[model samples]
Target chain A: MLLIALALLQTTPVAVAAAEEPIAPYAQSNANAGAKPFESDGMWRAFHGREGVDRIVDGLVERSLVDPRISDTFKGHDMVRLRRVLKEQFCHLLGGGCAYSGRTMKDSHKDMGLQTADMGALVENLQAEMNEEGVPFFAQNRLLAKLAPMKRDVVER
Target chain B: MRIFLIMLAALVASPAAASDWRGDGKLVLTDGITTVEGAAGGGIATWAVIAGNETERGVGATAHASHVALPDFDLEAYGGAVGLFDRVELSYTRQSFDTRGLGAALGLGRGFTFQQDVFGAKVKLFGDAVWDQDRVLPQVSIGVQHKRANRGAVIAAVGGADDQGTDYYVSATKLFLAQSLLVSGTVRLTEANQLGLLGHGGDKGDDHTAQFEGSAAVLLTRKLAVGGEFRTKPDRLSFAQEDDAYDVFAAWSVHRHVTLTAAYADLGDIATVKNQRGLFVQLQAGF
Candidate 1:
């Protein structure tokens, strides 16, 4: 009976999680998103809800990947995980009812040797994507206001 | 000394190679418009912001011209400024005040012009006005302006004592991105009359007095801002009472390299003319 049980266990395969490349173990919280969520759903609606925000995040990442100003910073990093966390972060900040599961801005950008120009480049890319979604200029600033403060932690140099 | 010169050149050129330090990088209009005094700020008030679009790693330059047409006078200023690594700013401006018909009334002949040259320097001390949105700290800087006027005889005839003087100031500026608002305040010490156009010192007194300049603006869009400013002046001239100045202005970023500002300005009094209010326009270009 024991030998038969051992053979069955050996044949069973270990599950590969669909969450993408693993990160080191750390506690996750929505607070890791940095700023507090908008007090109302107007912001979320302005962003066209979940689908819109996800597209914006993916679009920003894609643009940054090709942007020579900051492309090297993204090289060799797990973009799949980055896209996922960034979406979570934007959704939560926009009041889309999503929880963030990522490291602090300082931790995530650590050792990147990023500069102010790099931060400026990332902001421009994000702005272009937001504009692509037809977000109004005023509402665009509302989101930018929330993200601008993160520059303190995002730019190490 | 030759080796040191080579090292200095490398120190500056290596960064240029690394970052391509130029324009089109800073957020729109964060550089502010050129002040009439030639510093980088509002049309009338000085802020703690550097002069150009350069970040912490680059060099930037700006040139500007401004005009104010009053009921009895015309004021014009033209100048340029440079920002080094967003750290130090050096500037120069030539200003001319046309007394118009008032010149004849004051016995200085018709269309008499009071010319002055202002040389200014500023250095950033601490904080990041734009990026420190999460912190209460504001960017601060100290500056000095050496002003020399051309109409020494006219100034002395009007009870003035000197044709040249220096003004010192410390400024603080803060930007609240969430509210799309920017505010700046400056405290200046000087003995000049009429912004050093008439001259320095007076029969009233030659002691340097503290003056205040304050401004607040709302960001209407990425390329537009509307604001108001108030500046207090010293009542230095015994021959004519001097008053404060104020303005309400609109600044538009028409392109990456151009900014145009229009204002309703009030200079209070000039020489003997009272309620000197009028239209003011300025254009600035930067890289």
Candidate 2:
């Protein structure tokens, strides 16, 4: 029964950007997500599949936009595309069966001049959003474990 | 002159925290709480964590007051530490041990107190313990603690060889986030007896010997962790056997800037008093 519900969640429509600004062309691959997916679907079910990943991404991006420490970093960026790709990236990393259509972490963060503090602030926001979704602390850490290494790529400064 | 010194210190510190001064950027408790010896770590064992809320680009500080109440003795430590760029750490701690009524039994006057000071420095070599989850390497650091004991007469009477000595150590620490676990191991070379509270070296052995501090913690939440630590000691003075120490501890970050630690410590034996178990508590304010 739980598996059936999780499968149904995968089909639930997640919000996509109506339009995205075109940028310099780059190759897209699941590899661009910067982390490999979990081997078992247990992680996907733990995340409540697509619906949970969508909410977490939307919530994280929304929180980061207003967060004083990291707000300046998000200004003038394509938030719509950011939200969509974040969902994809999260879904893929969580083994939710979604293809990541984003650029590599280093390339996308190019010239952003992000500092370690910015990455820390963003991580704090992500933790908050994940907590708001009632994810177990252990499961939250599993996801964070995957995302943590990306700090090297995402924070260039 | 005082104002000039303060300004000079501020000027020296400002260059490292290039990230706009407010160094409260690292995740909560990642900076670690102050150990009894004034280094960032668990209750008793010094870890590889830098003592600050800063990460790679900021300067921060930590201060702590710790107390341990043993059956026949009581110990107190109060100190502060400065963290530079989350890379280098300097700390100072003053430790005082009160013998209570037991002092008179050893032919010393009542309430004989032993006081000592520990000045410590640690430098991180490499690896990000908290961040490098994809890798197997743990964060490593090397440190030195120069301890000075004040009761020279008592130390000499007990056959202790030196009143002051230096301890050298290297530590490795890692957080297995996926497992909600944190582990640390430290190897120290020292001739200190009873953590240098009884002075350094001894008639039995004046040479430095290798000791170990090992600990493991379960990360319960973002701000709470419970752990256990075991530390080996050098049995320097034959007058009284110096034994190992162990503790089970819980550390909670009540706020981002304040932490409280409580522990049940078995210090084994001290000054011929056997089974020196007690309650250990610490309050830390940082960054």
Candidate 3:
């Protein structure tokens, strides 16, 4: 069921982009949708081999930091909400998109004190998660820098 | 239960030799390269080399205890480090400098001694402080050390200050994993001259000077790392000329949960003193 949903998502942006135009060359038809999915897959392969992202996310969720309540937070919403958020965060950060409409950084951590100790704990948790996912250090660093600035806001002590 | 306990012991002491394992040495004092591991003096207490960033963010910690025995004197110290992140590190240490019979040689009463408590933190700014394959420049970091002199009179008599000031520094390190080599250098600016609080104000001029420090490490095999460092200090006190210090070290990983590093150190000057030779050791453990 998840695979079908992912496949549908994988094809949506391309189909939409194609539908907006008149019939073009069959060769151009595949190219017009852009090459982001392939590139994302390449990054996934470099750090975590086949199905790496799934393995990583699985380990991350098991760490208990993400909160099982997270699923409940968006449970009633359609799969589109989950996919859109992931695409915007991961895809845009990876250079594929220019827009991200998630909650403001401060809003995301409003209730949490997120002290120095907490941040340390989070970093350790993520390191373990990435290690389990086989993410390389350089690659992880690049991804982490995107969130580094938030340290100032997230950590109160 | 016996079998389970043995298995647990094996797991606890298992040697972890992976390039990425951060818990292979003393935890608290060693940051990626320039600060002490939050812990102190299980060995090599007289230098400015911090741990690599790779271990800073992981769960690894370093704990050590040291004893310096000489014909006329003996000393002891303890400390360790817990790496909060690859970017930030925190450390603490306490040292007891026993005068013993040596106090009489210096015209002081026997058992006259000094004690020091130090706390430190270092944060990496730019570049990878440990592994940077795409660039030749080593990783860069900045940190500060705050020391409190328990014996204010002992420290002040030698021209030291009552309140030990914070010492600031910036360091860069490069690890050539493919070649099994590591090199690091650091520059520090501080009011406390020498490792001692003894030199509060420079008798010569400005209170601060650029201290050049460097370290080199070579891996003889998968489980062994041999290294050394040289650092130059400024002459700030009229009473004594500060000399440089050097140390040679060898670290062996017996298992994933345990690694031990041993070093021979020479701290150039203490109260116009010469050639202080001692041994340094560190034990580290973590996931």
Candidate 4:
């Protein structure tokens, strides 16, 4: 049944277009529908301005502090510095051209005995922050896809 | 039952004590429960999602028990599956089919049962079901199931060609995260008769034929999903006609490690018993 529906949609150009339509809640218009996510620094910068970036990081840190699953890992850390480095790292990865000045993922996470669960918790917190900031799902996914490879470096167990 | 409890206890206890479990790295309501064949999927159809919460860097395993009670028949299955690197999956399932009064009528003796074993493996070909929101392409997987029926003589007497066979399938699954919708389509080529319990092939058709299976699910909450599935079947027996199967199900993730699913299944005509409708329930524990 799903295959038949998909085939039908594919045969009808208008239906296919409608199916491919973006459902971004924060999208002002469909003007960027044809634009690829993370294709250019301009797109990244426009999707989340400096203020949006700051808010996203702030949201992430706030959520992490209360998330029992990973809160222990954050103990005794300087949240202010951590937040600044995270913002810079995300900006750099998203093509904002803000060079990351923090330690490499492996070096920073080494000896911390970070587990896959901790990485998962952090990702969830980041996702929630993205949601709060009204970041487009596509944009968030693109960013995540870039950061996903770091799992090898961050997770020791 | 004791084994099931032991497995569930181990899954929960070990994960909690060691903290080695992957947790919620996989998307919520995305890692579906083990299907009857032990693959991750809906009631009757297989999806392309990998099993458990292995993600792309770790290993995860799940144990499941399912029961399907029909008007004239009942099926009980238990199995476990393991996902490696969120790419390959291997599973094993044991099924016991009770024909109830139908067994007596068929002269196989009252309360006679037929048992079968299924071994399955699947590999993800490409795409990401959860994170590929920017593209229309869905995750695709290719899989195979090898089935062996214990009652070879009975199957041969019923005009079955072989007591063992293999089924091959290709499945594609997609998740529209923002819309909280999931859709999957699978095409299987098989010559199995009654899912290989009645054996493979038959006098009517001794060759493999393509069958369709599909599912659509909606996430009502982070931990709850409601879905429906349709699976076409092969009519291989000359004695009785077989029809398609379908189910409407709701699954709840009670915790990161446990899921419970309940469904209303319409298996159409199985053997000569028409309208074999019933309730299906499955419990899965994983990490």
TM-score each candidate. Answer: 0.88, 0.93, 0.54, 0.72
lDDT of 2 by residue, B62-121 (tens): 778899999999999988787888899888888999998998997787899999988899
Q: Give the Å shift of residue B12 in candidate 3.
A: 13
Q: How does chain A of every candidate compare to the true chain A by TM-score?
A: 0.87, 0.88, 0.50, 0.72
What tens digits encode model 1's per-residue C-alpha lDDT throughout B1-287? 24324433543443356445634457878889988898998988999999877788787777788999999999999877877788998888889999888889878899999999998999999988887777888899999999999999988888888999999999999988878899999999988899999888899999899999999999987789999999998888888899999999999999878999999999997887889999999998876
Candidate structures ordered by TM-score, highest first:
2, 1, 4, 3
DockQ, per-model, please?
0.34, 0.66, 0.03, 0.12
| Docking quality class, candidate 3 | incorrect
Ranked by lDDT, the better of candidates 2 and 4 is 2
When summed lDDT is taken over every stretch of 10 residues in candidate 1 chain B, the lowest stretch is: B1-10
RMSD (Cα, Å) of candidate 3?
12.2
Off by over 4 Å in 3: A1-157, B1-60, B67-75, B197-199, B202-206, B285-287
Per-residue accuracy of model 2 over A59-118 as CA lDDT, tens digit each: 788789888888998888998788778889998988888899999999888899898888
What is the DockQ score of candidate 3, to 2 decimals?
Answer: 0.03
> How close to the true structure is residue A93 of candidate 3, measured as C-alpha lDDT?
50
Q: Tens-digit lDDT track for model 1 on A1-157? A: 9588445433321222264787799889887888999979999999999778876887898899999878999987987688778988989999899899999998999999887878878888988998888887778878888888888888876
Query: Of the candidates shown, which would achieve the greatest lDDT relative to the real structure?
Result: 2
| Best prediction by DockQ | 2
The CAPRI quality class of candidate 2 comes to medium
Q: Order the candidates by DockQ, highest first — what do you get?
A: 2, 1, 4, 3
